[model samples]
Target: MTPEEKYELFDRFCSNELSATEKETLTKLIRENESIAKELKLYQELNSHLDTRFTSEKEEEALENNLKAIGNSHFNRKATTKETKMIRMPAWAYAAAASVAIIFGVYFFGQSSPTYNDFANIPELSITERGNTEKNSKNAEYAFNSKDYAEAEKHLLILLSKDKNNTEYQFYYGLSLLEQDKYVATTRVFEKLYQGNSGYKYKALWFEALNQLKQKKYDQCAALLKNIPEDAEDYLRAQELLKKM
Candidate 1:
């Protein structure tokens, strides 16, 4: 589906306005398409943030009361000697004005460019099945999964030293560098991986795009994301990110 259509569906879904068939379709998409699921997750999160930031029942109530008071005061005012007239704005008009302001605030917030954190869904590192049984391997897995990138980097470096050609080590090592903002080192690792024939090729490309995204390099990120073919694991995610771009 086109981005516009997908987003429109998202809006309708969030508003609980979807018909039975549309709801079914959306449910199937979310279940079968990882990228759509992630997109919907992000969409819901953005809506929640907008609601929390812009909408307050108490504030709306106060504004409505204030508008009522102002209207009543204007109506009660004595007419001038020349019999000048005044028009009191309707209560709904005041509410509509407040709604417009909030809508504009949400519009501008939505218009802001997407960030790396918005798209980076890093997979958990697990090398225990590889039967390495090495301390550094275990430590790297633990640190990376726990989001301790510094510790992860240290262990990953040691692991890579012992197994320089291990793509799994290299991939997670690249991720560690990325989390630590070692942009130059991160891209170098990913570049090499994507250029190779390993299973990490497209995966590396995806993260490389995210690396570019972190640095706000829109053109380069878009180019990298477009290089991800349809059969790649991250193709759907790449398409979603491209739409945001």
Candidate 2:
């Protein structure tokens, strides 16, 4: 297809007005041309920007009208006997203005949606010693290593409740659950640790992938194992698991 034809097809695709043949033609052009790919991205962004701009404008107009009416109520009494110049707007103007003001406040002031700052201000918890005793930690670790999950779980739960942010607590809590054959709980704990930007990120992911394998969730297990960083401790094991999968 000619450049003009490709451009027209892309526009149609962006507007969702294209037929199957046109979509196929455009897709083929984009695959064969880097310029078309760039143009398609630009068009998508422009379409979104135009939508926001118009919505913001409508909001501003509504807000202005509401404020004008609130100012005119007292003035209208005197103006009623005199030559009146003020006009009344619908109460919906107030709602529109509020919506616009909020939208602008968010767009220009870098104000995020409620959830944007939700996690930001959440206080970080320090990992504390469960009983400030090395023996407890050692015993817990030993129980865990020996696959005596029941004893390990009891100790680990106590440690975790006391110092929830502790990496050791998180790891062992997950491990104990795994040993107890609590596959779903084990998966949830490990998945959280793995996906988080915490210190135990890769470790949790690696271990969770293993837990997935044990549960015979082969596809999910493979995907998670593949994401393990090469520098991570379990990278080699993950690779081995992938091959076995």
- Highest lDDT scorer: 1
For candidate 1, lDDT tens digit of each residue in 1-245? 88999999999988889999999989999999999999999998998888876778789889899999998877666445225435567899889989999999887676578789988998999997768798888888999999999999999899888889999989999999999889999999999999999999999999999999999999999999999999999999899889888
Estimated TM-score for each candidate: 0.59, 0.44
lDDT of 2: 0.72
Find the candidate with the highest TM-score and give its number: 1
Which segments of model 2 are wrong by more than 4 Å? 1-135
Clashing pairs in 2: 63-97
- lDDT of candidate 2 at residue 147, scale 0 to 100: 65
Cα lDDT, all candidates: 0.91, 0.72
